[model samples]
Target chain A: MKICVTATAEGLESSVDPHFGRCVYFLIVDDGSMDFESVPNESFSASGGAGIQAAQQVLNKGIDVLITGSLGPNAFPLISSENIEIYECATGSVSEAIASYKNGSLGRIEASNSPGKQGGKQRNGSSQKNN
Target chain B: MKIAIASGKGGTGKTTIAVNLAISLGNAQLLDCDVEEPNCNLFLRHDMEEFEDVTLPVPLVDKEKCDLCGDCANFCQYNAIASLPSGVMVFPKLCHGCGGCALVCPENAITENTRSIGIIERSADWSHVDLWQGLLHIGEPMASPVIHQLQEHISEDNNVAIIDSPPGTACPVIASLSGMDYCILVTEPTPFGLHDLKLAVDVVRQLGIPFGVLINRSDIGDSRVEEYCVSENIPILMKVPNNREIAVLYSKGIPFVTSLPGWNNRFVHMFANICEQLSTRAAE
Candidate 1:
């Protein structure tokens, strides 16, 4: 299964970006091989509908699972519709987040936690909650 | 002549000028184009009659015909449509109602449907002037559709029409200011007011509309606004001092022109001055 992690930078050592829609990079990892490729997020600076665009990009990548800090109103529906499993990881490096997910230690995000258009606000605790 | 009363900054007295000027003119048509929060009706004794619903054409995919071709999703610039392998999802709230998705669907799966975003109302009982306002539904992001509907009610017979425009230089404000013979850019003499007023000026200039400045609360801030106007050669149409009486009257939702009879003549004179400026510009 391929998993995508929102990251602040282009490497596994980079910290996880707390925003799904506006993350600087998306780290797509092949769980079987533990191999990864970092792709820059095109929707990071979109004027509006960043979440929708980001979700669409991830869906197009054939991602089976997503690891992010928070999902917004615009993105949650699109991601959920694709039957892609989502896990919440608000801190730690991209590799650590992937390990937690592999071990089933990370929390599954059941629904959208952040309000739409809160790109500038740092949303914590809610996305990190184990629900 | 049609004049739009617009302020880039809110609470800079766009409605105050619009209501008073329309009342003073007696034969003018007043339109409150701030659909999100229409408030011009508050100061006037008028009976409101519901006009019509403002609707936008959004696409509805016919699943029976749709093969999930992804064509409709690709064509939608607003990202309102998302085509997935399992099913297609349409986010109506994000839709700009451009109808491009329907046009692009080769399978003929997309169909157009009207979604009511707002409504318009006409006021009766305002002795001589006709008052109309647009009300945008809560949570509706677009206001231009309602403003467009309200503009359709502009009285052709009335020589003067005044639009109380929403604050800002965005799409809604552009919708309100479009096709006006003149725009009275009401502003205060502060940094925030000047900054937004410049943005508004850019919009009006781009639209190629003749405009003048009306400085509200003229005495409170610095003289930079006046200096800017003088340098730009933009006419300063009128000035209303920051008076305690006006503030008190505003808090009570009273138009000061009605209580202080002298202000009625002042508003009328301002209107006449605007007319004179328009005529002079036409001659040039």
Candidate 2:
């Protein structure tokens, strides 16, 4: 099974991006082989509907599961409709998050936890400070 | 003349100037293009009737004709349409109604469908001032479409048209300000007001519309706003001092121009000055 984690950087050592829609990279990992492909999220700077666009990219990648800090209202429905299970991990590196998922420690995100337009650095584990 | 009264900061008296100027001019059409929270009707005495329903054309995909080519999805800048492996889904709320999707669809699967976004209303009671207001439905993301429709309803018979544009230099403001003969930017003297006013000025200047500043509550803040105006070569059309009576009257939803004496002549003079400026520019 393939799993996608919203990451701040290109590697597994990168912290999980808090925002699913505006993440810098999507690290798609093959669960069995421990192999991975890093896809830069083009929709990170989209003015609107970044979540929907990001979700479409993930869906196109045939991702079986999604791991992110939070799902916005616009992106949650699109991801959920595709039957891709989403797990919430607001902290730690991408590898740690995947390990937690394997150990059944990450919480399942059944619905969107973030409000519309609260795209990045406003929720948990955001490195940027809100001025 | 089509004059848009816009302010970058909210509660800087855009509505106050719009309603008062419309009434003062007489034989004018006052269009409230601030659709999201249209409060012009609250301040004006009128029996408003529903003029027309405003709708946006969203895309409707025909599944049978759609080969899952993802052309429509790719064409949509809004990402409102998603072409999943299972099927294509169109999110109407996210759609900007640009109609690019339908044009891009090679299979001709995408069709235009109307969705009600807002409504326009006209005042039946007020004879001198034809008050037209646009009301956007709750949870509606786009206000520019509604503003575009509202401005389209400008009566040809009216001598002057005053548009109360929505706050901030965004899409909705552009929609309201576009194609206007002139724009009256209302602002206060505070630092916040001055900052936003600069932004609004940039928008109007970029749009190539002749605009002048009308400083509301002119007495409260520092003289930096005046200095900026003088340096920028922007005309300070009118200055309304901070008055306790005006605030009291506004709280009661009463237009101070009608309730207070001597204000009518001041508004009329301002209108005449604007016309003179327009004519001077035309002669040049």
Candidate 3:
């Protein structure tokens, strides 16, 4: 199984790149039992739409599961629409998050963990199209 | 007149000067454009009276109609739209809500949707000063929408509108200073202060707005800030000395101008001088 782990620091485990405009990180992990190559998340530095880029990277890799400490409103739905699974409340090292995902200890979150229900609106898998 | 109290750097007493100046000037309105971590409300002690949600128009793609031609993705200056072989994706945070993608889409697959990013709260202490604050949601990327909402509270009747801009010279800062009559760049006497001060000066100058500097903690650090001001011919409007008493008062949420006697009068003079300088420049 291939998994993408988003961590605060690089190389400890795959860490979710913190959004430049908003603060938060995601850890995505592949849960399938297949041998998969690990790809480090490319840092997207632009002020707007970093989440989309991150999601696309994960989706392109055919990542099945994401393990992270928190997810924000912007990237939360995009990942879900790609049929990727999200596991929240996993913390500490990236290895630990992966371990939790493998053991089914990581909790599934259908919605975002953003405070004040900020991410709730975007969880419906509707693609936000701003042309 | 719209008077913006801003510093190129943080912790330079921008909020300190803004809160006090609004209070002393009485009948003025204070707009805290520092939406990320708005702290002016902490000092004013005004009960928040009204709250309004702020959102930006992000794109919503109808997957059934999207041909994934990537035209919408190509049209986005920010690369917010991602076109894959099988589907189209929209990254809302990266989307500037320009609506250009929808305009150029041949299939007309893109539609506009609103996503709430923050909230603008309105409150007052009945002391004639009104407080309008923008609070950015924890994970939302765009802050300009909230800043725009806070701007709606700008009272034309108020003789002065003091805007406390965000720290950096980014989109949020630009949104705060847009259409302002005067921008007061606040800074301290330090190397970092000077570096950011120059960056901020470049931004304001590029925007073609009339501006000046107010040096806080003037007694400490190097005299480089003064040198820069002289070299740039930017007027040094006022200087607030670095004092422990002022620091303590600030931590306790007391406006230094009121807690320490005579500071309010200094601000009055400073504001008057700013107005006079602007007028003089206009006449010239």
Candidate 4:
């Protein structure tokens, strides 16, 4: 199962990048195994649809799982639409997030916690309702 | 004369230079074309008098009269429309709103729908300068449309119109710089600054616009920017030293030329030089 991993802002631990806005790092893992390659999310400038483009990359790669500290409302729906399962509130290193997923220690977040304004609720998988 | 201040990278002091130049010129029109994050208004502090909503036409499909023939999707350059097995889907963000898709639809299924992308604001006083700013709503993908709306306010009779462009050499920057007499590229003296400066120069050259460089925070970085300017024969119009006073004034929403004395004269001289060059070009 391919996985997309994002670290929490508070859990960055390492030095932060000034150019890219408020991102720790993003990791895309394959097959739910330890084999994973880091995809640099720093290229997403705040002005452009960098975040949306990055999510498109993950979709194109057919990532099945997304392991992240916190997923913003903008990113959450894009991934969920592709039928990718989201595991939220997971923190620590990229390795730990994966390990938690494998061991089933990662708690199953209900679709209710899906990170939209309406109590994590979303209409139609596209999120175009707000637009 | 219309002047556009732009840079290939962010944090290069494009706003700083544009705001100061507009203030110094006294009878100028200032345009902030950086719709995504227009910081020039923060410094100008003008009471915004006019606000106009900027909209883009996205294709609205009427499925009733339609056979899902998918011609609309084929004609769209942005791939904004998708023909699924069920019906047509529109990705509003990706839509360029060229209306080509609507024109190509044989069944008359697609029509134009207005979507609000941003707003254009104008503020002016008889004693001071006029300020026009574009504010792109957050999550809006298109900025060029709003920039175009901001440009509509530029009066030909105005003595000077100074535009603060968005960062990067992109479509929005192109839209902002279009029809301008001169472009002043603000860049730092650092390696990254030099790298992006070359990009900005290439963009201006491609647009066939006259451009010069203003090296901001010039004291900190290496001489590469200067060397490149000399080698390329690109004029370095002015050098703003890295100073704490400038920073303090900027944070306090004060124009550096006004809050910090003596800088106004330098800006005046710079504007005179720009005017002289423009007049010479017109004469030739």
Candidate 5:
């Protein structure tokens, strides 16, 4: 299975970026061999709809699962179409987040973290300040 | 000729300048394009009449014909259309009404529908000034459509029109200030005011409109704003000083010109000066 983790920096030691759509890097990892591809989020600085754009990019890549902090309302619909599972990873490094996912510690996000059309840090509900 | 009074920051006195100037120069039209929080009507005290409805075309999809190809979703830059496995979803609030989704659909299932977001109100001011203002519905993000509706009320016989533009150098400001003959850039002297004033100046300059600064509450803050204006060679058209009585009267919903005596003539003279400056530039 392919897993996409939001990362703040390049390589495995980078901490998991709390914001999914606007993250600096998306680490697309092959769960079987632990091999990864760092796809820099081109839509990170979009004036609006960055979440949906990022989700589209990951979906096009055939990512089976998304491991990130939270999903925005705009991105929720984009990722949900393919039945791609989304897991909430609120803390730890990208490697640690991947490890937790392997151990079945991360919880599946059924509903979008953001309640409405509002996005990013302003998103309420499942989104936390610490992460 | 149309003149727009715009400021990047709120509370910089756009309405104060607009209302006073309209009263000062008789037989002019005043357009309050600030649909979100229109306050021109507050001082005008005229019984407003709804004239027209402002609507924009948004797309609606026919579910039976749609194959869930997701082409519309890919075409929409705003992500207003989402093609889920179950069906297609359209978020009207997020849609910019660009009409691209309908064009990109191969099945020709998308159809146009008008969504009314705002309306225009008109009121006559004692046969001297005509007031036209746009009022956007609450929770409506798009404001330009209503502003455009208000602009449609401008008639050929109307010689002078003063547009009270909304605050901020965003889409709303651009919508009101676009194609204006001249813009009276209103600003205060404070640091925050000066910072946003520069942004407003940049916008006017980029649009290639002839603009001059009108400093309201000039006596309170430092002289950096004046110095910047002088250095940039942008003329200072008028200076309305900071006065306690003016604020008190304004708070009571009384226009300063109505209570403050000599301000009426001062605004009239300012209007004359604006006409002279604009004509002089045109001649050159």
Candidate 6:
């Protein structure tokens, strides 16, 4: 399965961007081979619907799953509609987040998360309450 | 001739000027374009039994026809539509009801429907002048749409129309001033008043609508407003002194022209002066 992680930079060491739509880059990692490619988010500075536009970009890349800090109201519906599994992470590097996801310790976000929550709130799919 | 009474700042006598001027020009049409807080009807004994609903077209997505191509999402300028991973999302509040999404949908999944934003009410017995007002539903964000509906009342029935424009230099005020023959910028002589007045001046000038200033409460504040008008070569058409009597009458919803003796003639003269200025500019 292809996994996409929202990140601040196009590398494994780059910190995970809490925001999904306005993230600087999407680190697409092959779940089995561990090979990775980076796609720069083109709508990082969009005046409106950055999440909506970004979701379409991810869908075009045929992403199976998305791991990010938070999901906005606008982006949540798009991800859910495309049948993409979503994982929420609190705060960590891309590598750490992927490791947590592989370990089945991350929260699986069943529904849309709140928009751009910075800290002390449920962000990751593993830690997020299913309700 | 359409005259829009606009004030850069709130509580700067826009309604006062509008009601008085409309009454002064007894035969003219009075349109209260201040849909947000329409208080112009307070002074006029106008009936409001007849109301016309003002609506704007909002798009509905047809799931059977939708291929999830995201064409409508990309076409919406207001970012009201989005093709999501789970499904599609539509934020009706963000929609400006432009119907672009419906037009651009490749799959023919989008259909347009009308949503009422406000109502246009008319005075059944407008003997002196035909009075019309736009009343926007509370919490509705789009005032310009309602104002656009109110403007439909304006036609060749009357040579002149007096419009009570909403306060501020935003989209609502622009809607009121659009295609107007003249704008009466009612303002006070305060720092805040002058600051916002400059903003309104910039908007009207940018739109290329000929306008003049009417300094309400002219004697209460400093002379800076007068100086600014003089420097900008903007005509100061009238000066309304801040008086307790005028304020008292306003509280009772009575026009200053009704309470103050001979003020009707003054407003009549002011209207004549505005006509003369407009004609002079036309000739020039």
Q: What is the C-alpha lDDT profile of model 5 across B1-284, one tens digit per residue?
A: 89999987778899999998988887889999988778898988888988888888888999999998999988997767766656777877678889999999999999999898988989943587799999988767678888887887776676689999988787888899987999999999999889888999999999999999999999989999999999999999899999999999888888899888899999988878888988999899
Q: For every candidate, what is the interface RMSD in angstroms? A: 11.8, 8.8, 11.0, 12.2, 10.1, 15.0
Worst 10 residues of 5 chain B by lDDT: B79-88
Which tens-of-lDDT digit does each residue in A1-131 have in candidate 2? 99999999998899999889999999999888879999999999997888888998999999999999888887898899889999999889989998999999988999999886733323211111111
Pairs with backbone N, CA or C atoms under 3 Å apart (clashes), candidate 5? none
Superposed by TM-score, candidate 3 places the C-alpha of residue A56 at a distance from the truth, in angstroms, of 6.3
Model 5: per-residue Cα lDDT at residue B240? 93
Chain A alone, TM-score for each of the models? Answer: 0.88, 0.88, 0.64, 0.62, 0.86, 0.85
Backbone clashes in model 4, listed as residue pairs: A1-A31
DockQ score for model 6: 0.15
lDDT of 4 by residue, A51-84 (tens): 3444555555667787654444444455566667
Order by TM-score, highest first: 1, 2, 5, 6, 3, 4
Docking class of 3: incorrect
Query: Candidate 6 chain A: worst 10 consecutive residues by lDDT?
Result: A122-131
TM-score of predicted model 3?
Answer: 0.72
lDDT of 6 by residue, A1-131 (tens): 99999999988888898889889999999988878998999889875567777888898788998999788876787787888899998588999999999999888888667643222233221121111
What's the chain B TM-score of candidate 3? 0.95
- Give model 4's TM-score versus the native structure: 0.71
- Over B162-247, each residue of candidate 3 has an lDDT whose tens digit, in order, gives 99987777677888889888999989999989988998899899888899899998999999999989998999988889999998
Candidate numbers sorted by DockQ from highest down:
2, 1, 5, 6, 3, 4
Candidate 6, residue A30: how far the Cα is off, in Å = 7.7
**Ordering by lDDT:** 2, 1, 5, 6, 3, 4
lDDT (10s digit) by residue, model 1, range A31-118: 9898998999988997777888788888889999999999998799889888899999999999999999989999999989888763
The regions of model 1 sitting more than 4 angstroms off are: A118-131
Per-residue C-alpha lDDT of model 2 across residues B1-284, encoded as one tens digit per residue: 89999878777999999988988889999999888778888888789899899999999999999999888889888888998888898888888888999999999998999999989999977778889999988777778888888888887788899999888887888898999999999899999889988998999999999999999999998998899999999999999999999999999998898889999999999999999999999999
